[model samples]
Target: MPPFSLMRCGAYLIPLVNSPLAVAQTTHLPEIEVRGPRDSSIGSADSASEGAAERESFQSRPKLRPGDIVEAVPGVVATQHSGDGKANQYFLRGFNLDHGTDFAVTVDGMPVNMPTHGHGQGFADLNFLTPELVSGVRYRKGPYFADSGDFSLAGSASLDYLSALPAPIVDVSFGSHNFRRLLAAGSRTVADQTWLGAIELEGNDGPWQVPEQLRKANAVLRYSQGSSARGLSLTGMAYQSRWNSTDQVPQRLIDSGEISRFGSMNPTDGGRTRRLSLSGKWFDKGRDGETQISAYAMDYRFDLFSDFTYFLRNPVDGDQFEQTDRRRAFGAQGSRSMPNRIGGLDGLLSVGAQWRGDRIGEVGLYDTVARERLSTLRNDKVSQDLVSIYAQQFVNFSDHWRGYVGWRSDALRYDVQGRALAYGSLNSGKGHDAITSPKLGLAFTVTPQHELYLNAGGGFHSNDVRGATITIDPQSGLPAERVPALVKGRGAELGWRFQPNDDLTATVALWELGLDSELVYVGDAGSTEPGRASRRRGLEATLRWKVVSHWRLEADAALSRGRFRGEAPEGEGDHVDNAVERVFAAGVTYIGGPWTASLRLRYMGPRALDTLNTVRSRATALLNFGARYAVNEHLTLGLDVFNLAGRKGNDIEYFYASCTAGEVASGACGGGIDDRHVHPMEPRSARVSARWTF
Candidate 1:
């Protein structure tokens, strides 16, 4: 997505949203005056969804994964996934920053929220996302109002699309993982109206192919009108994806002197996702101001993975456990605007309403030595509904100061009718619940070039923790546990943001966070009560600068400490999941018209793998380099050389071998033992690519 697409699309949407929302001639940044998606764009393509708010994000090539983009903001850190080839995760301010918190991620407004129990080591399909369809991307740090839900602990990333352009574009690239991709987009003007379309396909024969191969495609279609003085516009789209299931690795192979062996030796994905959306907006800016309404729907599924566990950790005998998931959802949101003043400066008021509904089902089955189906987990049903109302104000005090604040509340209700998980004495359980949530936020600039902010927020999660998945809880009577209720966290940040000019942007922040009701699985033995309290505090900082357009420099670093506030006799919060001591990122880029080059170095400090903290892990750093060059007006080329330093493992890596412990590693037997000290990771590799755009 280009930042300019929104400005272009907004050239027409502004009237429908309200003409008062449009940029006046007086605003200093003329290049981003168009109020579409982003508020600014630098060396990036003219089109970007950068927004008109104080937010944070990692930066990366559009063709790359979200993990590749974490360099955008300060304090955020991500590690490569080799042991668990799942979603890329970032440690937000020394705490666990998974799909649940730290930040919410979305593509073209589609939220990606999927998490498993116990460890934060799972991955989803966002890796398949391609940047070709993105027009703009918005990021927000801290609490956001009803518009974004209460899911963000560190922040949120919002992406926008621009389907309209004077010309058509197509991009194609190939590299490692048997990696290959094709992305194409185009726009057409008709009867004074414009329509846009995009299609993207990515496939890889991933290096760790213990039968692991991935292929995916995403398509989009949208339409808009010319400059709409009447303040009215409309857009719609559909998207779909299909891929192989996540492969778990076999522990024995590593102990047998094979650290980089594929476990299953034959893995496959049996899942797919499909979605569609349509929205309408009416901004009678021709009248008092602007009013807008938009809505969308999604349909998706996760096919059964028949005993892929043998791929991660082997049992004497191969067993297969697979399940299928079917899901559908729909929602809409509308906002109205009015003029105002803040600190005797220009300001705007916005009021909005939002609603959505969801339905899901899961089916399970067993696989035999001959790959025959056995039985299935009983069927299940779930329905959820959400409605919210919110208002916000954006104020520009002067060329040197700006302020923003907002409030929102929600009425939520949901129910589940299925064979709930069995926790020893607890069974035959089905449940229903409802909640009302409120959120608030504020940001102020101490100077035009620096800023400070504080926010308070609330939200809930209907974690679809299937009953069959068991994590032994710390209790005497209960053999297992069931997942229920939403997790909540609140925190504050004192930070400074400085943009000396378009050439550079930097930030530093110190923060403390509290998760009031989040769940954690811990204890020496299965016990009765829930987990104890937990706390996280940390410091984060980053700096980015464009040097003479021909050279760019960037660096980000984070330091933190976290732990269980109190020792629990039995229950969750026994230990921290994503606690880290330090993280750093440094990069440089050079642009020479048709050719652009970039190099990045990443580092992580040593960390503890267990709560005992008796043993610790090592630290590591790697260098990455890449380049993009134009072949012609419609063609371009790109390549990346990662882990150029060829480090064996990262900070989170830990492994045990025959030379170590006795019974514990032997798991009740006297056999030679190998304890997993830390998660395993992949080493240095290289990738290359090419593309064409019109």
Candidate 2:
């Protein structure tokens, strides 16, 4: 009776004592056992917290840039206050996602934020990303799913790249303030088609006292033919950068020593950027079920100079400011998925569409000093458009129940011209908005491993069609009030999941969100201000383990609370300013043989810098370390350590009002006064790397 069959290790199905003609006359076969996912309920919510740096569970993780790869997504928190070519400061759950509104970032399907942005309002910008050609990162947080639209209510991330590459590489790195880097990558397949290439160069001068000197460049090219779920692809990208900034400083000028603590109230504060892109993709999965298509184009540029109120409002050109952006973007998307039954219940159906456009010759705001430009507080020429459509359904009336429903619709258009500047007057505008988002999910499979979830959603974030059509106030011509170009959101979630074997897994969530106004688009006060209407609540937890067979461990934690939905003043206190209350992260990894190691820790808690919370911010922790060694087989060597205990934190903090240089004002000579405004943290750094393969 040596004829048996059934083998599928992961969700269990073992039983194969000998089959396939007794294992083709037996030469060896018998010994298999590797488990996980016995019933991880693949239906709704949770399960998509991924990362890969060539696997082994994140290859000794440690990243200093490339936006730190979204911090591997567990409660995300990336920060940087000035130049690193700008655009990092993220933080999640308790909001404060300023530069990227409520998250949503993508690569490969293109679109990385940037909606009517010149700086602030969904401005994503991962410095064009090279990160060794990524190759995996998928994240999800709130706003259920429905293909997530528009800055996705506090969640979203998708990055994938790597059509080929198993060898052919060169990498070099050196660090500690004078940092330097170079990378080159390759892949090839010739006639059968498959090519990929990459290039990158970087430089840094950091540890500031005025010496940021940044500078970077990157490039990539790709072409593919098939297989990756059936495919065709083409891609190209380029990036450039420059820097010099050390903004954010004033805790009474480092407590009156007048500057230090990585000082710089403006040191010609700086920025410069550029990006170019082209993309294309097509996919098909036969047996009557899947199809996908994508397209993209982009060219962008930005110039920035900031001085977060060093002298409060042009106290003789010291409140420096200048932000300029030029853009051209295009997009397209399509999708389809099928298999259905309805009445008899058994389903799956998906449909999608998306389109986007932006042609902004310039989105400006200036009033600078050492960097030129002396006035001109708003100058624009923007044209924006977006359209979306979606549908989703997934059901399985049994096997422990499952459900999902989705709908999405969005349309937005805005055209603005206005540019006469020197003193206001020269306007032209238009606006239109629409939104419909609905999503629901449910799952219940109480055994086999455990699962339970319920989610609800509706989301939106869009505003700044010149603040939905302003009429004046290009820096005070007065008479300005206009907002609402789509701003609505509501969310809820309750979840739990547990995988009891094959190396553990766990998750838990409880959430709530609401908003209808938080009116943004005040690029340094060029308009739009009127906010209040918010609510948020949260709790999240996660853990993953694989404590043997090479070891691994991870952890996540988050807690939140935000407010602002009614009264304040008298002693203030409605919180919601900078939200963010408690967050924690942990990591551990070790791979034997050729050796690899990792250790990480992060925490950022305590936030509230106004609304009479009497200023708060003091809880930031960091510890990082990484190691790699393999000096044989194609060579390799690596090391990274940052803040490993040098901890003297403060990566961000703000409370406003500035007057520096012996303040005492009644008007002019650096007026306006109130304290705190840090941005320290960076001392104990190291990096060293070398890799080669052919």
Candidate 3:
């Protein structure tokens, strides 16, 4: 008889049973042994802290935003600093990440990070994602893989969507603060091809004096043929959102009872954004080996109005500023893998290439009040291009030992054209650079249930083109120093994975990373600042246990230290500001015939807020609970409770000097006085949902 196996599609694992004749013909074939959970042991050495999460893991979690889906990765934390329309703040391995500067994110093989973005470099916004279509998530927590390059110093994640669904589903939800949402998704097969479609509509009025009236619309369409390993697919997506914002407030104002914690300094603060994209992928498996190719094109627009200093810049206009970004981007990637034999030993060789480009029509900053632009501070057009090629070889020296070596080279070019504005002509220049990264990995199988691994690699992150050749600061008109087009990173890891039983899996890793230099473009100032080189070391541990047939438990913990590389002068400290030191997460999940429940706790530890360590941020802990009950074969009801403990904490905190109405004359208005700026966490909230499957 032919061999049979199980294939996972969405939340179902369907059995692929073979016919009697086929099974009888294949009975003489060699036996294949699949190891570890979901074949996670395939490349134990090539990646440290890398694995996949099942669909149930995502469906069971209580998430407020689509970006929260990334929190499924161990030791990864996602937070929000401003409006709901913006990208979530991401932190991993002691790096602040800052809108995805060090970490890379992708959805269905399409890159999510925007290079040279008006708000920040490598800005990654996940608002467009439809969580219901997600099939699985694959993540790696180090720069130990050759396939990932730019913005992957801290780690990388790839989210995949199901090509087909078992049935159509319609979900409607209502919650406190006037929150409402509706989603419809389904798939159909015709002429040996599968087509999938989804649409989502959401609206909310947050608990704030300004009432964050957020409205969003999202849609997706996909067509595919064959299986994931050898299939062709085309996907199109659209998303749009607009919302009012309640930005962080000064602690002095809140402490003096001048305003509430959820009060906004500028009621006009808000943003609008839209994205349209088309992507395609093709894969083939033949007698020789396997090959895969992908291509994508995208159009995006963003407009934001913000006021942080609240009268520090223009006392008359109240320090409100507007930022605008519009761009078109395209990219392509292809790879081929082939089996080989070396000295009577089995091995594999892979080669890949990628090319991407972005044409930004308008990236501008303007002084504004009440959403009206007063004057343009800077305006320019940017064109950026990147090309990379990589090769890797994996060899099996023996049954218990294996190793891999990889090399990658990347080339980048930047071109900027200034738009003459009232604030003087913006700097226009062109620059290009190239870098080569190498990776090495080794693994040893100690026993059937235990494995050890060691990995070392190099990675990099690109800088904004405006910061690479600017001669004058657009905000201050002072001489501005240019930074390197690409900053290099080096990292190493030692790890172990153990599966004592079918129900228990554990992993532990110790890693360290160093950077050549820390240079970032300050969006608020329209200039680049050079920071000291830094080093980070950390330890991460994770546990997954299926306690029973209907219950599971998961726990993860991470501790890290970050500091400047060189010695500091008198009165100076080596601490890295905003670098998180510790993070912990635990969750319990239950799945039965008609009832499901989940409870989760997340903790973020305190860290320094200033270069001198004189100021520090307070730790925060939050609890969330969710439950779902199936009413019938096609009906289900669900409820989620956020901030279950009703803890009073801040979502984010920073120490900086700002000016206010009463403190302008005391030498503490324009950068003299130091006070904490805080964005408090949202209080307890509840949401109820009903889903119907057809």
Candidate 4:
């Protein structure tokens, strides 16, 4: 039978394959056929912190931006300080992963995090994501898996896109602040092959005093043949966006009535970016073994204008600067798995290898005013390459006991060519590094519905190539010490999973992670910053309960503490700046006939703003609401309300020194003024959308 569309029944959505309203009519519903993600059952999962979210979960949540889709992972929060066209800020565990550093993300077999980027190391931009095409998200915490390599120190998430859709769809939306969007998607089968395509267009003028004026376009085309057991696919994607941004501001400025909370110090602070990619994959599965391989190539460009200090660095130029990056990247990965018998026990062995290279034509930083460059600070052409190999063996010692051990090794090489005359020649160099990590996991099933797990692993994040080879500081033109090419980390987790019944599932985990060094390249400052060793320990809990036939509830909470490992310099303590200490989220959903509604609440606890632990930031909380109604078989409508309570809070905050024009003219800019800089969260707004299916 052809797949039928989803139907709302009470507080949940279920697919209707045979009959409409079949769930309401029967006490024992048909077996659910969720196909994309693997089940994280007692015997199948290695840790309690690992889980998967399917398309249904995505459909039920109310998201404010494309990157919000990753929030499906418990204890992860996605927020933004820049305009809609930029990557969302991600916070997970106890770490504020600025632009996805230490946390890896992927779609299909293509990596999303850009290493050694102009803005920051491991810069991940998901603005091109098309939510409707995502089939599932598989997330793992603590870097315990052998298949994951760079930027997996904190965690990793892999997203899978669907090869076909049940029906063609067209969607349109409009919202407060002149937000508008349109999407069209479809799939067709011919000659035993399926072809899928989608296009999206969006624009928004935010509530900021200076309009965001965001414009974005995205497209995807894919072709696939056969099933998961044996498949071949090719895909192409394109994305482009431009927008003006309201960066963080000093709270004192707002308190003194100098500017509104949602105002920008420099209206020209914004960015434009574009990406084009082509990828292909082939896989085969059989009783003897399984084999999979994939390859991808991309052309990317980025241009950004930002002013963080007003007039601190260059009082005459207003401290505004422009960053430009253009690169061509290519990568390929292949893996094979084989069934085995070890000591008369069932077992499996898997091995994989991956290779990636980036040819950066030019990555530069310059002094600028009103978005026009005045003088170059630094510019370089870079070539970086990486190769990784890993192997894992999984064995079932008994019906209740299972374990796995793995090992991985990675090698990296970098070459830099100077383009600018003043600071480029002295900083350009060549470097190479290598590292190996070991991983192990054990799981014990105490009962049919309960499981205990222990996991420990070593992981690492590569330092920016420029930082690893730097001989001079671009800003000050002084001799600089080069950092190690790779920084190592280790983590351990003890977890429990309890699933008493079909309607209830709960998980709790106690985890700790430590890094050998936190040294990294500071993109904003055009230099490298030294760091100390640090450690973080945390407890996380998640709960999901189906209260009744019409109502469902879910909640997640995390508490963590992070500190430097040893003594600190005078006037500074052990606190890790911007390390989040607490997080909580809860939601309720209601489904009745063709109607569905949901309400969600999120909280972020206060954090230290400086290493001294003297300055701290305030906690923040917000609420959101969403509802959908099926007008007919062909049309459906949706409503989403963000910041439902119109809360006045900040999306992000920092303690820093900056100087305004007035301060500079008055000679008060001496060393700048220390203050709290913040980016206010958006106020209450609503969006209405319509989707048509045929």
The candidate that wins on lDDT is: 4
Instruction: Give the TM-score of each candidate.
Output: 0.76, 0.33, 0.92, 0.94
How much lDDT does each candidate structure score? Answer: 0.51, 0.76, 0.82, 0.84
* Per-residue accuracy of model 2 over 396-437 as CA lDDT, tens digit each: 889887878899999998888878554334456787889998
Q: Which candidate do you rate higher for lDDT, 1 or 4? A: 4
* Best of the candidates, TM-score: 4
Tens-place lDDT digits, model 3, residues 1-694: 0111111121231111122211212233233221112526533535548887656766798898899999988988888878889888888999777788888999999999988887778888999999878777888877777889899998888888777666567778889898888777766665447677777778887888998888888889898887535789999999999999887789889999999998888899999999999999999998799999999999999998877777776655667888889999999999999999889999899999999999999998888889998878778899999999999999999988899889999999989888846433548888899999999889888898888989999999888877787888777878878888888989999989988776888889999999887643332442235577889999999888899999989999999998888877677688887888999999999999999999999999998887688899999998999999999998999999999999878888877666776677555576535788888888899999998776
Give every collision pair in model 2.
none
Off by over 4 Å in 3: 1-39, 42-45, 422-426, 519-530, 567-572, 665-670
Residue-level lDDT of model 4, residues 1-694, one tens digit each, is: 1111222120121122122211112232222233568537667889999988645545677888999888878898888878887778888988888888888999877899988888777788999899888888899999798998998888888888888766667778889998887777766655447677877778888999999888888889888888659989999999999999998899999999999999899999999999999999999999999999999999999988878888888887788888788999999999999999999999999999999999999988888989988988879999999999999999999999999999999999999887888978788899899999999999999998999999999999987788877888778888988888888999999999998886788999999999988643332363335488999999999987778976788899999999888888787889888888999999888877888888999999999988887899889898999999999988999999999999998988888899999999999889989988899889999999998776
Model 4 per-residue lDDT at 429:
91
**Candidates in order: C-alpha RMSD to true structure:** 8.8, 24.2, 7.6, 6.4
lDDT of 4 at 525: 68
Q: Is candidate 1 or candidate 3 better by TM-score?
A: 3
Candidate 1, residues 218-252: lDDT per residue as tens digits? 55566666455543345555545444543333345
lDDT, model 4: 0.84
Clashing pairs in 4: 10-591, 11-550, 11-591
